[model samples]
Target: MTADERMAAARASGPPAPGERPSIAPAGRLGSLLVSSGQTAVGADGRLIAEGRVGAEIDLAEARRCAWQCTLNVLDAVRADVGGLERIASTVRLTVYVAGVPEFTDQHLVADAATECLLRVLGPEVGRHARAAIGVAALPTGSPVEVEAVFELA
Candidate 1:
């Protein structure tokens, strides 16, 4: 499948639910840069996809799936902001937050799933980017994983 098709299939459930405050901010552009608001593992219908701490309640595999969903949400935000994915020159960076126990040291491993998802849909060129994976005690909406990204505008 093409990138667009892959993205659509991955997001088969639909885009993230809109909030009183939109996830794709109105002012999403700054010169050649485009920013996406952080997205959690919320389903298209506004339900949390993965809840609780990763190590405590959810396993690594579940956390990884949640991370993939979060990145797909970010892509949807970018698509909304830019009018098309073609406008994205490249992914600049990604920040992934995983709620987990203090002993959890595999946040980076969870983040790899997100990166792989991006690469699968957007190709290596656009998907390659710097990333940070952080383990936190909690996250908004009790989501196990959240992802936010920056892209360079074409």
Candidate 2:
């Protein structure tokens, strides 16, 4: 089903069934956590299609998963929020931040996870943007990764 359709169905079913949601990681800073809710936009089913969050605590493997999922979540939101994905004129930029220990400096690797995901989804269009992957002491919600993008809308 289309993302919108999937969202609608989810909404019809009401909040996720037990265990359907990814557990919230411990809040590190800013008091209560501020997650993306994974849903960038409401699909036709009236369900918000949240694919991932800004900061989550997970193993490196889970961090990688979160990177991919977060990018997809943004892409899905972009499509749903801006009318449709086809309307995307150009990908102007993507900025990814990874929270890690002082010893962990492979920020580029984590950033690529999201970059590659966007490339697979946006095709050559992904080539037209600037990207940065930086390591930070912490993210808003102890989220392992946070991704932001600037797309030229058609």
Candidate 3:
């Protein structure tokens, strides 16, 4: 499907609710760079896709799905800011935060979900980027994962 088609499908599946606006700036221009605010795994229903800490209240697979959801939210924010995903030149960076127990060492695997989603949506060339996977004690709204990105405009 085309980017527009994918976006429409996502909206139809339920996101942003009716008349709901983004809680953050979404994306901001810093010279030629576009930086997005951190996005959590909140679903269209306004609840975290996966909650609690990985290795305790949540599992790796669920954490990965949460990360993917966060990635989608980032894409929505980027699209809203730039008018089109086609305007994205390259994904400069991705920072994924996984809420998990200190013993959890699979944070990178959780982050891979976001990377995979970007590759699928934006293609390899533009999706390839520097990334960091971090493990934290907690996340906003009890979400298991959150993602933030920086992109350059085409």
| Each model's lDDT | 0.89, 0.62, 0.93
How does candidate 1 fare on TM-score?
0.83
TM-score of 3: 0.84
Candidate 1 residues lying further than 4 Å off, grouped into runs, are 1-27
Candidate that would win on lDDT: 3
User: Per-residue alpha-carbon lDDT of model 2 for 41-75, expressed as tens digits?
Assistant: 23345543332332333446656665776677677
Q: What's the TM-score of each model vs. the native? A: 0.83, 0.60, 0.84
Tens digit per residue, CA lDDT, model 3, 30-144? 9879998899999999888777999999999999999999999999999999899999999999999999999999999999999999999999999999999999999888989
Off by over 4 Å in 3: 1-23
Question: How many residue pairs clash per model?
Answer: 0, 9, 0
For candidate 2, give the lDDT.
Answer: 0.62
Best by TM-score: 3
Q: Which pairs clash in the backbone of model 1?
A: none
| CA shift of 144, model 2, Å | 0.3
Collision count of model 3: 0
Better of 2 and 3 by lDDT: 3
lDDT of 1 by residue, 29-105 (tens): 78999888888998889898879998899999999999999999989888887798888899999999999999999
Runs in model 2 lying further than 4 Å from the true structure? 1-59, 126-128
Error of model 3, residue 79, in angstroms: 0.2
